[model samples]
Target: MSESHQDKQHKARQQKVKQQVDARIANATEEKGLLLVITGNGKGKSTSGFGTVTRAVGHGQQCGVAQFIKGTWENGERNVLEKLGVEFHVMATGFTWETQDKQADTEAAQALWQECKRMLSDASLDLVLFDELTYMVTFGYIELAEVIDALNHRPAHQSVIITGRGAHRQLVELADTVSEVRNVKHAFDAGIKARKGIDW
Candidate 1:
């Protein structure tokens, strides 16, 4: 009832939380690279992957990114990462909605998959970002088994981040950390078109 009483309760709760968190942190002794999957219908999947890439670059770690879908539109993250000496690769085009020519898309995705394999095998890289990789496998552009094999065989110290919607069940299960960004509401839902600098 009194303000002092409320303050005492809050402090007690804070202390309890601190103790729990500290205990968990102390128990986490094993250190190794992680396989992280960011998937869902939400818009921040690629953003989150790129954000991690920026963090890796900030740590002066070798990093590589293979953009499987996004077109040649100017990318701020790629520009900054490349400036920071990150190895970045982008395909020739983004996914196109069409009635025919699925073969072209598959071929392009296969090419990117090869690049992804190279990046995965590079022992020098501390982190690798496979942007829109889920779509590649889910859409049958690349073999899911091949993707999983590469990821599983990557260097023990190499961390990876996958971003896209509809991530394969096997990939999600293989990931040490998996986050599904839910879309409660989006600007596109509100009829607002994507804008540069904000969307990109």
Candidate 2:
């Protein structure tokens, strides 16, 4: 066969293989529910979590959200999600750095975690977002073993999303999908405060 003809045949074979792979991915239903862990030192961790919550709500799925470190009043996402009947539980102690009390923060985190655990185990909830959850595990404020147990024990058809910086290796290993949001750049580093709708 001519060299060009051979190259064309190889390309055609590669296209056929690609089509088969795509078909498999499209038809595969072995894994329906997912454990998604989003972690990194950049911005938008909770934002990404909330985005997923919104998506789930739009799809007529019951969703729950538990905020770990942030408990400040009236964020746009919370307001929108609340209007959609999405369940939300905040830590009520605000950020750890602002509180400057480890014990107090831990206690608040534990309380919120209890609610999150219940939501996670509930088969009625299609999706549960654990916002800033990595902070609890990273600081040892919440028991890692208990968290793993709750995640593993959740309903087979339920999806869970955990977002925060410094996610534990064990949690990452347990997760069905893990996404690391790298910090390429941020306005905060340039002396600009977080903007409404965009940041919040």
Model 2 lDDT tens row, 1-200: 56698899999999999999999999886966799999998888888888999999999999988988876766898898999999988887977889999988888888888898899879999999998998899898999999999988899999999999889999999999899999999998999987878887
Give lDDT: candidate 2, residue 91: 89
The residue pairs in collision within model 2 are: none
| Per-prediction tally of clashes | 0, 0
Per-residue CA lDDT of model 1 for 45-80, tens digit only, reads 999999999988888899999998788788988778
lDDT of each: 0.89, 0.89
My TM-score estimates for the predictions, one after another, are 0.94, 0.89
lDDT of 1: 0.89
For model 2 the local lDDT of residue 110 reads 86
Q: Candidate 1 has which clashing residue pairs, if any?
A: none
Distance from true location, Cα of 145 in model 1, Å = 0.9
Model 2 spans > 4 angstroms off: 1-20
